[model samples]
Target: MSGDLDLELDPHAVGERVQARLDEVERAGGPAARAAADDAVRELMLLHQVALTRLLHGLTALPGTAAALPGLAADELVGGLLALYDLHPVPLADRVAAALPRVAGKLGREVALLGVDADGVAHVALTASGCGGGCGGSGAAAAEALTRAVQQAAPEVVEVRVQERAAPAPLLQIGRRDAGVPA
Candidate 1:
């Protein structure tokens, strides 16, 4: 099984090979072919693990090497990992919810949302709580401000709209609309 087949790292090519092998396995006489194919896949995964480990080790050993990689830039790599995987960093939704406590403390109430744009980017969408009225702004005005912020932060986000929920509940539904793709 270990020596039956070679594996390549190209994901698309690997997918094609798997499809072909599955077809062949389906047509094969019996247990022998299935066992061989299973062994081949296991070997391929082992090879991948070995190769990736070696690559990371080599990169880490080279002086200043990790610094030059695009996605490996210190801030992005650190921030991305922290935001996505770290336990200390609050969950994004929870962070948004926690902001509510502060707002609730101030306003003596909570807010709800009507609907947020379905097309908006998930990370940039409005959460359970929003920018407070500390700016002396109305809900519509705050929504517009948030829209402008989204536009500036991600110009690719072409449109933003929010629906305000009923009174005594400060809810806002934000929607993100993507810019049209060029024909």
Candidate 2:
């Protein structure tokens, strides 16, 4: 019991490791064995889904129970369950908007959501905060950071495009002499 209690695992990390193991088995076991394994995994996932659904129903029926939970933990648990059932109440756009702060932290700047296109492309604009001078390397790093954040937060997003804010155009003198002649 102590050994079991000592093992702590992140759900996402466990899923990734399980997937890699499945791929290995598939490679070694051929098509028939791989198909059998796939079926087993699918059945197990369904069982897990049913259990979660029942637990959620009970928790939600209990007044004030869910509200008593901490914000982040509740969000993570609900988000995972919703994603599993394809029933997330928040739209993809709003989800991306919520993820901007963490992405901004990684980029060392503020990020604004431009919107998601019909093709599942996420458009984000980076605000010039700590990013002074705006060198090419820094721009690339910012783009990569936003991409990583969006991908993790919203896996349904097929791509991420970082839009550079347009620079202010140089002011033009309207006076005839100033417009046509040098100072």
Candidate 3:
């Protein structure tokens, strides 16, 4: 089991390596060879995508197997595969939304996914729920945690931007003391 067979089974690490090689090909190869390589890689990916889609459909059509998809979608490896092929039952927004609660718990503030931009950057809004959202710790840490969570949950997200939600206007309490009834 020498050679590449000895490589670890980390899908993301392998995928990154493959992407780096593709980038290198794009950079170094001639136009025609680069185009051909790109097409070949795309076609191979599409083939796997179609095959997996069919397999998932068939499995879900089975009586007992239908209930297993959500769990599969939540699993790290299977979820990553499903996400890579855009076959996950959960939407990207929902996945990002789900990660916000955990971020909120960690930051001890009310956090939410304001929206995801077209460039795959997730904009998160941090509201002043507890401690006025002004904790002494670094906001960068919160941003980093959020970025990591969203990316880990949905790799389609390319980046994360954390923003402070504007504090609500103060409520002014104005009550006439019963026309001089009491002081």
Reference-based TM-score of each model: 0.32, 0.65, 0.76
Cα-based lDDT at residue 160, candidate 2: 94
lDDT of each: 0.46, 0.72, 0.81
Candidate 1 lDDT tens digits, 1-183: 687554433433555888787768958846687787778877887776566557656876899865554344223333233332221123333433333334334433343322224453323223333435443256655455555443332333345554444334556888666678543
Tens-digit lDDT string for candidate 3 (1-183)? 567674337777888998888778878876776788889989999999999999998998899987788787887677778989999888889989987888788777778788988888888987654455457235777778888888888888888988966556688999767875866
- Candidate 2's C-alpha runs over 4 A off are 1-3, 6-8, 68-82, 87-92, 105-110, 116-121, 127-137, 151-159, 167-183
Off by over 4 Å in 3: 1-8, 26-28, 117-119, 128-136, 166-183
Task: For each candidate in turn, give its C-alpha RMSD to the true structure in angstroms.
Answer: 18.2, 5.3, 4.2
lDDT (10s digit) by residue, model 2, range 1-183: 576663344556766998888888889988787888899998998888788678766876899766643343235545655656644546778878888888677655667999999888999998655335553237778788788777666666789999876444558978556676778
Q: What count of clashes does model 1 give? A: 14
Best by lDDT: 3
Q: Any idea what lDDT model 1 has?
A: 0.46
Best by TM-score: 3
> Model 3: number of clashes?
0
